[model samples]
Target: MRPAGKQPLQSLYFDYPLFEFRQPPELHGGDMQHPVVIAGAGPVGLTAALALAQQGVASVVVEKKDTVNDGSRAICVSRHSFETLQQLGAVAAFLDKALGWTRGRCYYRDQLIHRLEMPHSEDERFLPMYNIQQQYIEQFLIDKTADYPDLIELRWQSEVSELKNSADGVSLGINTPEGSYSLRGNYLLAADGARSTVRELLGLRLQGDNLPGNYVIADVRMAHEFPTERRSFFESSGNPDATVLVHRQPDNIWRVDWQILPGDDPDDAVRENNVRERVAAILAMIGHEGEWELEWWSIYTANTLCLDNYRHGRVLFIGDSGHIVPIFGVRGLNNGIADAVNAAWKLACVLKRLAPASLLDSYSPERRGATIDVLRNAGKSSRFMTPPTRGYALMRKAVLELALTQEFTRPFADPRQVQPYNYEDSPLTTPEAGAGEFTSGPAPGAPLHNCRLDEDDYLLDHIGHSFTVLYFSIEARPSSELAALFAQLYQLDPACCILRITGAADQVNEDDVLVDASGRISRAYDAIAGTVYLVRPDRYVAGRWKSANPEEILAALRRALGGSKP
Candidate 1:
């Protein structure tokens, strides 16, 4: 195990910066109090800090390590994750550095049997997936936090020794390079990874089963002409009776994984020479004749473990600390990103006194429900990729065999990719209107569809860090009642936004209105005259109506805020 110290870890293709750890004011008895103190300076923790900062909340992030993680772990980022990053003002660097792709190919016995194409449209701002190393992910998030120095304080080599929870707040005993000190936070966010110290100290345990089969994941640097697409091989000559997955990443670093046969010695699977031989065979099978050097390697098994609840009084768990999803659908990091965003926004509302404390009670249900959904889909992929029983193994073989001759069976090879989890059942979501009220659009608790408004503008681009209302008007000018409703909305919450969409191009001169000259945005949202959609701060639709009344809109807003008393 790596020791807890300020030593900068080495990476083959990435430079590691030695972050300086300064003594905290608490060590000098200065009695510093943080609004939110985040544990574990990983991608999720840093993302939570950034998301909080975006909501005008301050946080202090503590880490036991000195720099970014060593290996290229969690290399896949989904488009939904990029949208979260966009809200935090940190998507530019990622968009510039990550390799985006949407195509995947699956082969049975070296013969291509299935091709997977993820959903992509011209209205979308990002592709389906982006391949970037985790080290770069952490570093990019850290760099983005620099824009909010007052809001985010990163402390390296600081480890939590003890935690005390109270109704008022949380007291954390932190050990640093200098010495041990204590800090108080109104709330603590545990973004720690699989082996969570907070969960242990709190005497909480994750509940679920760890699936079977171990796979050796390795990264190699080589000059290859492969495009950035996923390739899966089943029963290949390189690794018979097992599955092999390959992905092309930036910096000429390719990630490869092959399952370890049941009878094979798991220890020998990762041995330097054995890994080299296996990688060489796989490369040859893929028709690559170029030389490659091993960078890093590790072993992992599929697991669907998760905590029953994410909130523990003052400490709210996010990321792997709360749940660990299988990597088959690339839901691990992407789901963590979603958790951070969801919790951060609700925490911000509570801290700013915009909503009651009960507002946070909905976090566990929404995110944990999403985790459960991931487990269901990922379990299927896991069983197919690495069968735990002979029955499952035979079933997989039969499916592969049938897929070779039967075109209709090819769909069985599909690795169901991750999708944005809908919070339709969330307590915070206002009940939607009757099903037939609207023909097409995002239902309550669904994420807003990104629609193109012009050559350079999209619907989500106009969103700010607050509750949003989209009002579709048939008249070139809003009626007096609608104007009064807008006034009432501002009076209720000045931070709330009322975006008026009109077909009249000349009416676009208004600051709060968007001109649907092409009607594409309207069509995408299924917006008709007098249609109203209320969106939460996290971009999920809170409620929608065919014709909205001021009282109904205010009531829905209050309900979305956990039925807070106005």
Candidate 2:
């Protein structure tokens, strides 16, 4: 493990997972059927595979590329993504290698205009964000799949050339290093990427707008002490009339994104000579006298495109295949991770007969709702970063100009970081009135709070596939009533992991009781004695009540399972 602030072994591309086809049974004779098949081996696809594996469902992940991602794209991993990674059992490696930060700064020309701090305190398990290269993330996820070798089968250099979906399942024609083969699966995950073959074969189209502006991202290696904070500059003398972003990565590598004019030829913009010149000029502008080497460079346009729907029959789209948003607020990868978690749990439930197959239908609405939310949020940052029209550019200019002087205008210059998306309106969550005696924390459909259960334990570590009925009361342990409540809960879903939290710690028994040592959980959840919460597998607040009512809890639990009221 690379210790925090330690450099990694310098490398260009991540190591590949080689899968040799030596008399594979699926291809040797008849078509082999699997429970789930993932079409891409990127972070999202691999995460989906691992998620299914954790639920005891087997999956086959197919990847055209032989190795992890090339270069360092998507450098920012949001805290929400880290939570999902922890649930998939790949977060230990990530925490060791990732650069953690909680603050971001915005500058106009040379003056510091605004500073935004993400919510982080001693009570939280992880920080607001971590800056790790995309390749490293993919490598960590790949390492995790090895732990569940029987449950996860990773195929390298295997591309889905064609796919046909039906009422039963999806039929896929895979082209591999060995030869073309065929396989059938009960469900297919189209995490193939932005240029998805599954999407094309299915005759689906992404509908949205693309900004006219483009960004040249140059990853350079150098040693420096830049406090690991997100920094953005607009109309700076170093890179005059352009917007530049700087983020620090591990191994002494740094990623700088320079927004270029719309007229700049994409071909010439990515040239090494041009990229180096721009990078060098910006480095000098920032007063970095240290020597540096250009490692890699790429160009990307600010796009806010997504499918009209994320689900079609047995095929579910995830990651860039389903949506594309600006990278400024770090929503792209985070939202993709959410897609994997959301789909993984629901898919596993249906495949295991724990929930009705109709549960899968709710995925599109919930995730599509999330995608729309991302588009709406990222659209603001996209327009702010790359103003599409002259009027918008002038607006930004005025905002940046006033930000230098007026304190009130400084908020306008701040890049509103990604928010934990709420599914209050999702079909899966039980909607209810927020009116209650103590209404704090998140209501139904909101992302659950992550608090420190102990020095190394987290409250989220206990949330999973079953409905976790958090009986937050003043009881020292499971009361008789609570035992009966869980009896019904276990009958409804045996996967549930129950925990009791209370205001008293010393009075509680050690088994099945977690004392809110710091009262953060109770304060965060606005819980009093008898207050209870039903958290879904993805750790979203499925339903909460001021008091425990077995009938009401069971009714909401059934609703979360996509079944009618009992």
* TM agreement with the true structure for every prediction: 0.96, 0.95
Among the numbered candidates, top lDDT falls to 1
Q: In model 1, which runs have C-alpha deviations exceeding 4 angstroms?
A: 1-8, 474-480, 491-493, 564-566
Residue ranges of candidate 2 with Cα displaced over 4 Å: 1-23, 474-481, 504-511
- Tell me the deviation in Å of residue 208 in model 1: 0.6
Q: Residues 330-354, candidate 2, lDDT per residue (tens digit)?
A: 8888888889988998998899887
Q: Per-residue CA lDDT of candidate 1, range 30-95, in tens?
A: 896799999999999999999899878999999998889888889999999998888788899999
Tell me how far candidate 1 lies from the true structure as C-alpha RMSD in angstroms.
2.5
Candidate 1 clashing pairs, residues 3+ apart or interchain? none
Model 1 lDDT at residue 367: 95
Candidate lDDT (C-alpha), each: 0.89, 0.83
Local lDDT at 484 for model 2: 84
